[model samples]
Target: MQTLPVMHDADTEPLDDAVTRRVQARVGTVLRAKWRIDRVLGIGGMAAVYEGTHRNGKRGAIKMLHLELSVDPEARARFLREGYVANNVGHPGAVSVLDDDVAEDGSVFVVMELLEGKTVDALAEQRPTGRLGITEALRLADQLLDTLAAAHDKGIVHRDLKPENLFLTKDGALKVLDFGLARMREMQSNAKMTKTGNAMGTPAFMPPEQALGEWNRVDARSDLWAVGASLFTLMTGRLVHDAPTLNQLLLKAMTQAPAPIRTVLPGLPAEVAEVVDKSLAFDMNARFQDARGMQAGVRKAIAWLDKHGEPQNLVPVASLGTTSPGAVDSQMVTLKRDPTAPMAAPARPSRLAMIALSLGTLVLGGVVAFFVFGGSSGETPEPGPVASSSAGSARVGAPAPSATPSVAPIAPIEPARVAIEDAGAPPPVPSVTASAVKKGPSVKSGADFGEWGK
Candidate 1:
């Protein structure tokens, strides 16, 4: 755990200097006797992944906890828990966590097998319609379910499941990545955004339960819903639960049945439709309960297609097609990311400042109101002189026409405030210290960190 120097925004900085420093320092300490870090591969919520080579020249990926998250005990524990869970599961489709430990600064780090190729999310974007064909989709779904099956049996649930979390190897093997260690940014971001509005799976892929925030109640059946949505997108090149408003989206999810698979992809066999419909059933009880059960339907679909002489396996066709200018190409269609994506980043202090400012402004106004009312209290001021009507005396110009009446003021209600949780205060800046190479603890061999955290 290397500590990072907190630099100001104006500091002309290397985009990843702090992260690089931490990784280099940790590798020096944990694998100093064995490996040297080369470069950062990517950064996520809790970890920065690096490509490294052992002293013996063996290459691997080294993952270290993000400094911000590592300092928090709850976060650190979860980070290690993800690694521990990954270490227990053994499956070809699952990436293996090789080793793990805490750095001197208390950052959690895990080493894993380095993999090549893009994530499923990336592949979906590269394709013409953001989808794979029926055959390819089935195979991928089968692989995903198989991984989920092993985890489900052990009581592990992939609370977060999405394209970005699933990695595809260069060899065309589908391997589940970030099994339980997806960044907190991704997790919190997903939770806040997966409301009653957008479909929970994705704008297009979200299932009903997820859209309704029932994700916690989700079982293996919830994943089946996602699989069904994925397959539908693959075959039809259209989203089934799409609506401009969240309300309409939920309505479609709960009531509207997906169009049969063959309806969109002409020549698709009836068997494929049956399998998809069964899985897409609004009632989970009607859907396959486990991955093995779902696999049976997929196998049947594949066998039928093979026997019918339909394309037994569809190759991923690339060309996100375009028709009208600036119009999203249906084939190359992808949900565009917001310019300022609303991820839950740590900016606790700033939020606190805003709250304090609002409170101070309200208190100041209240003090002013109290003094004004106090002066006007007690005896009411004598009524102004009134004019005599009958007599020309014009006695007292009628109560100088009661100074134009003022509108009644609304009573102010105090706003209920949110108590901000303090992200621990920053630590003292330190002098430059040369990193020492130290070996990390050895993990037990043949210990399977089962899937989903089981």
Candidate 2:
């Protein structure tokens, strides 16, 4: 028997080696009287994917469960379930599931659109220490969020989100692959798919809640955590959660806090780091409320960087809040005992916060003043006299509806006064009178004012 080509994941073990060779020897074998297998593409714990062709010259990838795994009813159910989920998603970002069926020997197989591009893992390998550039990372992240946002809208949660499951098309579009571990909100109660307390995913990228096997608690936000982890790995070339063993890995994911991106890549942009940090929040509520929210935030950050150049300094952790759109927090980073950093955040309120507070104070002060100085009193004050500047000083004493303020009315509007004008002059300029019965030039009983000494 020919040996099977090896392609294994550390966290998951493949079926028995004897069974693998028995399947690998079937290369060049035709199936369904219409599709022919070319060779083995790769092998996973449960299925072996192959490059295959239909008699009509159509090309695609075929996912077939090894004969050994096919015998088990549970494994067969999973193999067929993946095809159903991928097909139901019906989005361009998700790999298109075409056909699924059981061959003559009861070996199950699924046909999918053959993609020519590499997985994100392969792309990462070609980059600088597996870390992508800031702009590239943002660009890719935007696309991925859009994918998850679409899936989320369909009530599908991609529980297993990782670089291995994300395919970067040769044309530069991103395709989210692998739905074998996804859970449908509508299909949750189905016994064929529902299995609680048995979490199946790449542990490094799994969110804390999912890591703890809190299956029922998982939601769209759970996928968001993986999105964050993928981006973290994309830019830093390191897993946000890492360990030497599975138990320790799951433990760390559930109990440990991911190091801030700036801690690993100190030169990363603050806006970018902030968005990633929030997406990876230990509390689900602290994360972007949804995938679309995350998309907007990333775009907002990228727009900021485009308009105002990137800043190269770090700030205090407490100062950082969820940097969503319209929130007051944007300068957040993981605090690492660097309170003395030159560009540390201020302890006082933010500049925007201070401005808002001052405005609020002004408004409150105005309201108080209105009540104290402009509010109604127990008694009403009589209307003041209107002094007629044209009538000269004699008009002040004329109590017959003149423009001058009434002397008797001063008791109500206490300590208040008005100005009378010299209307006879070229221009009317009002002058304040100290005394209601004034001896000054402002008003008079029978004296000449602006006319000077006559």
Candidate 3:
């Protein structure tokens, strides 16, 4: 018999040596006359995944139940049920199960969409401090909460949620893996997958109720606790309760209150600390009641980070409201303004208002000119306080006064003259003309015309 290496972690128990050999023997063999097992991916307590290729040249992952467990009807039923539960999650983050069939040897197998990515735990281990940067960590956490919100909405509680189960693809998308231990609310009364006193899930990520095996009390909030614990580990590089023995670790998770996130990373923003701390509260009621509520808390922390110059790189997995696009929270959209920057200029007046103002100014100037100089009588007035030659030359769209003295010179309006006088500057020249006023001045970009211009 050939021996195969079994991947073991804090979350998965190692299979017996005998069972390991039996699982490895399936390699190079075809199942359902289509998917041919190429190699073993990983072996766990209940199932082993194999990389398989179909006869049609398509590739997929084949998750096969352990030969030992397949003999038991209940175990086979539970193992096959994973496909149904995960598909019902109705989220893009959830891996899709393609097909399920029974092997010739009586073992059951299910093909799933093959994913290419490292688990969160593996990525964290690659980092120097075994901790992700604040922005990256929160971004992943936000995506995780979004997936959980979808699962919770379907009345499914993922009893087992840990760093190892979250896969971050090369394209920066997060996928939630492993729904084998999920508990459907509809099955709570009729079927008891786990006895009331038998503990389940990874001890490091399990909440008080799940660690103590209070199956009845475990609900959506229990999953939130696991999310908090997973984030605590990703940000701090340490578990909430670490011990030498599994029994000691489980004991601590059941009885001890998790240390505040700030205790581990003191420089963490208060908004982030509050969300993680509240999620890990010993009493489930103190934690976020639903996935949406917890998601909102995470968004607030992200918003706070944005204000503090800690922008995140990950794109949002979902819009503000999962169902309604218009229900976005104001805090998430609003950014803090820079106090040192100049105040924004007020809104500009409409084109119609600008035309009206220019027309009014032209009519008033024409009335003053008519009263100052000769009117419709067509007689030139005496040269009293004669306007400067420069003023007449600058008048736009108006003919210059005839050298024969038959035409009267136009003077600048009193208001225009007052404005120039207030500046204590040179003699002002008349610029506005009847034709020019009819065709208003062109508005140039960034040009400020004071209140009227705006």
Candidate 4:
């Protein structure tokens, strides 16, 4: 498995020449008459792993120590040793190495069985709490212990054990990976970073003896300590020990006790928490002395959890990749309309109905006008008493016309005499002068002059 890059400040240092050479291993380059490199998966300081296919069309991982590192006696030895150790491990829980060779370019490469599942760390990131459920975590831990026991039987000590080195296969089998740090014996003085204290394992998960840089003290028991640390992370979703710097980490692992699983997670089964806590004991003698012993404890924990019904809180969303935005329980949201949502469109009026309605409104307005002021009456009805303060009070003469006009008011008429005419003909009015004018009987309101004549 690939390690996380220790990213440095860009301004502080230039990109290493090894990084450029890593990509130089061209894709589709047939190697060893069988394997063809398809692409580079990742590159470390001394090597890179590529995706490749064999003559049988079986795909696998190809790890190649860079030419620059191949020339170095120590790097060359370590890279080759990893392949040998992993090959000899001969356990289904460990990745199997298929072949190894020195390329024409003078770089050494080893092909391993391709694993198609996420790293433990990747699975943890997919989980909301960075862990698996109690039952599953215990099951995985049991698998890891079995692998470690097998490796220990072969006299292999895996110095580096962390979430990144653990893989969950597509079939849900746990696989231990990256034997690069594994060894039958301690590293020679030449590999030390400092003459005094240079640890080989990841700081967060390293055991006390390993953290102290006492390579001789790291053996099967030390690996078991690492297993405990792994269990702590898998169960509690946190590192067994934490610090900001390497020195702080070493100081804590060497001096302070690891926080109990129960302390981080109170509801966790006490039996399970106890087993993980013992594994992380600062004193090597206080921890499980062998892989078998640790494996027994893990089995017991699993049994306890099964009997008690494991905590449901740690079950992660089933995921093959990173969780997407707003996704939960492995379900993706659709932006399309919901089939269950209500539709509320209004009913539209028909064209014929609208036309009929408009015409009916016009006919009704005409009828209203006929009743109000369209009598064709020549006689004037006396006007209603006007309120002096009203804004619409009419002047004595005429009212101004509006869009729908009221009929005009009539002017007061002076009395006049009419000359008599024959029946069936309308009466002719006498021309009135001041001397011939005569008073007629007062007419009641709204009476037509023709009616008065009748």
Which number leads on lDDT? 3
Candidate 1 lowest-lDDT run of ten: 445-454
| Residue pairs with clashing backbones, model 3 | 348-454, 349-454
TM-score: the better of candidates 1 and 2: 2
User: lDDT of all the models against the reference?
Assistant: 0.52, 0.62, 0.65, 0.60
Query: Better model by TM-score, 1 or 3?
Result: 3
lDDT of 4 by residue, 1-454 (tens): 2222222211225337556544444577888688988765544344556678899998877877667667766567766777777777788887788888998788888888776666665566567666767777778888988998899898888777766577776688877777766776444444432123344455566777766666667778888877877776766666665554434555566567876667666677778888888888878898898888988998998888778888765432232222221121111000112234444444555666667556655654555455446676855556655434222444344443234333222333432111122234321111110100011111100100000000
Each prediction's RMSD over C-alphas, in Å, is 18.4, 31.3, 31.3, 41.9
| Per-residue lDDT over 1-454 for candidate 3, one digit per residue giving the tens place of the 0 to 100 score | 2233454322334446787778777889999799999876656555677778899988888888777767877677767667888888989887778888999988888888777656676678667666687777889988988999999999999887877677776678888877867888776765434545556566667788877667789999999998998888787776776565545566677788887876656667788889999999999889999989998998898888888866334222221211111121100000122335455454555666666656655655564485556455777754444444532422333344333222222333321000011123221111110000011111100000000010
Compared with the true structure, what per-residue lDDT tens digits does model 1 show for residues 272-389? 8778878877777888888889988998888776677665443322232211111211110011123243444433345555565566546544543444344675665465554554
Displacement of residue 309 (Cα, Å) in model 3 is: 2.9
lDDT of 1: 0.52
Where model 4 places Cα greater than 4 Å from the true spot, the runs are: 1-25, 185-197, 312-454
- Candidates ranked by lDDT: 3, 2, 4, 1
| TM-score to true structure, per model | 0.56, 0.65, 0.64, 0.63
Model 3 TM: 0.64
Alpha-carbon shift of residue 443 in model 2 (angstroms)? 99
